[model samples]
Target: MKFEIKRDRLLDGLSDVMKAVSSKTAIPILTGVKMDVSAEGVSLTGSDSDITIQTFIPAEEDGKQILQVSEGGSIVLQARVFSEIIRKLPTNEVEIEINGNFQTHIRSGKSEFHLIGLDPLDYPHLPDVQEDELFTIPADLLKTIIRETVFAVSSSETRPVLTGVHWAVKDGELVCVATDSHRLARRKTKLESVQDEEHNAVVPGRSLNELNKILDDSADPVEVVMTSQQVLFRSKNILFFSRLLEGNYPDTSRLIPSEYKTQVTVNGRALLQAIDRASLLAREERNNVVRFSANGSDEVEVSSNSPEVGKVEEQLLAEAIEGEELKISFSAKFMMDALKAIDGQDVVIQFTGAMRPFILRSALDDSILQLILPVRTY
Candidate 1:
């Protein structure tokens, strides 16, 4: 295989696909990136069985040439070394050549490197899920939804299913739900679907995080295809595929209480900043717990007390506080995460009771919700 390509374009493609390569994989080939050059363009692929990413550099985009293919063939080169070489090359253009024996040579300016390449034939074939079910959404909106909820996914591997975010379709709306037992995050949006069918899938949060990094926040739509075992997200010339986690996501509908004892509307930034200051003292405690207490309908106190680090107390005026007055303690980290995900000026916190899980939501939109379990502090 031989190709002369723009270094910036190649580097961008490599950077996108490199997220799939796992250096600790048992299969040595999985640690490398596969390059294929054809008359159409150049394609780079990286995978670690669970996730695969492929990016293509077309010969011409918008009437401008981005790559020049001299021959049609394939080769696999060590990902770390190949990526470093391409990134550090001194020129805007890079030339790559591969011999029949898989010896790969890369040249730019006066710098050259010969790398032992593997036959691309040995690379595991990515699963081809027929496009039976497909949907499209704006890339920026999708990234925003992911950012709001993916962080709530369980980091523990004991129950592998909880490590992924649950996606479900109902009434033309797509909802993403993530939880780590202590807190939960949910985001919903309207999606274009082909049929009146309900679709449910659990996608790994790690894969979504990686996808978010590579996807540009543009108005362009991203096409998604799904099978029972896998899901694929396509944007422009890039393809991202991930294996679905095999297990039923916990039924979370019942976890969200239908009613509340108290509801208070407070400034999102004010509450976030208050919790941030409280966390400084709470960090010395067992669970980084912070306490919130409401005084009538005027102000709310955010405080934390540490046996070794003293205490901190801050008061923020509430826009409206009603119903039963409440005092609740919860993880400051969880509260801060929930606050950051809310996308409005004022946030509404619904307290079921002192010990029950409370919810945080934007005063303007009901599509997004964050729930945190309160700790018992005597």
Candidate 2:
């Protein structure tokens, strides 16, 4: 394979695909990126079995020539060294050449490097999903949905299913849910392709986070194709694929309560800052628990205490308070996560009881909900 490409253009495509390349992959070829040069453009692919990312750069776009291919072939190069070389290349132009045996040569201005390349034939091919089931969502909306929910996915590998976010489609709504068991985040949005379609899939939260990073905030819709075992996201010249997590995601519908004994509406920023201050001392504790006490009809106290480090107490005025006064303790980190996910200036927290899960959500937008399991402080 032989190609002359702009250094910056190649770097941009390399960065996007490198997100899928894992340094610790069991297959040595999986740690390398596959480069395919054709008559029209150059294609870069990286995968680690779980997630695959591919990017394409046309030979010429507008009046600028991004890549020029003299020979059509493919080769796999070490991702770490290849990415580093392209990033630090001194010149704006880069020339890459590969022999029939896959010996690779890279040159830019006076700098030159030779890398032993592997035959691309050994690299695993991406799944050719033939499923006709697909939908389109605005890139901005997809990014918003992933950002608001993927944060709650469990980081522990003990429960493999919980490490991914559950995506459920029913009626005309698409719901994304994630939970670490301690807390949960859920986001729902209405879809234009309204049908009786019912599909449920668990996608790795880490993969979704990477997808969000690669997606630009544009008005163009992202094409999403869903298969039983894989999901593909395509936008512009980039394609993202992820293997669906096996096993049924636990039914979380029952986890959200239908009623609440105490409800309070408070400014999201005010409560977030108060909890942030209280957590300064609570971090010394094992649970990092912060206590919320509704002292009056219009005000609530946020406090935390550590036996060794001391204590803190801050008050926040509520926009509205209803039902009986309530006091509860929950992880400070969970509260902060919920606060950041909410879009409204004020938030409504509904507590069924101190022990049951309570919901914190935007009072104006019912599409997003955050639930936190209270910590036992007694």
Query: lDDT of each model, Cα atoms only?
Result: 0.92, 0.91
lDDT of 1 at 315: 86
- Please give, for residues 1-378, the per-residue lDDT of candidate 2 as tens digits: 788999999999999999999999889899999999998999999999999999999999998788888888999999999999999989999999997677889999999999999989999998787657777899999999998999999999999999999998888789999998989999999988544778789999989999999999987889888889999999999999999999989889899999998999999988998998999999654678999988556899999998888989887888889997789999999999899999536899999988899998898899999999999978
RMSD of each: 1.0, 1.3
- Compose the digit string of candidate 1's lDDT tens values, residues 1-378: 788999999999999999999999988999999988898999899999999999999988999888888888999999999999999999998999988789989999999999999989999987798987888888999899999999899999999999999999878889999999999999989876546678899999999999999899998889988789999999999999999999989999899989999999999988999999999999554788999998685999999888777999998999999899889999989899999999546899999899999999999898899999999888
Output the lDDT of residue 167, model 1. Answer: 93
Number of the top-ranking candidate, with TM-score as the measure: 1
The global Cα lDDT (0 to 1) of model 1 is: 0.92
The lDDT, on a scale of 0 to 1, for candidate 2 is: 0.91
Best by lDDT: 1
| Candidate 1 RMSD to the real structure | 1.0
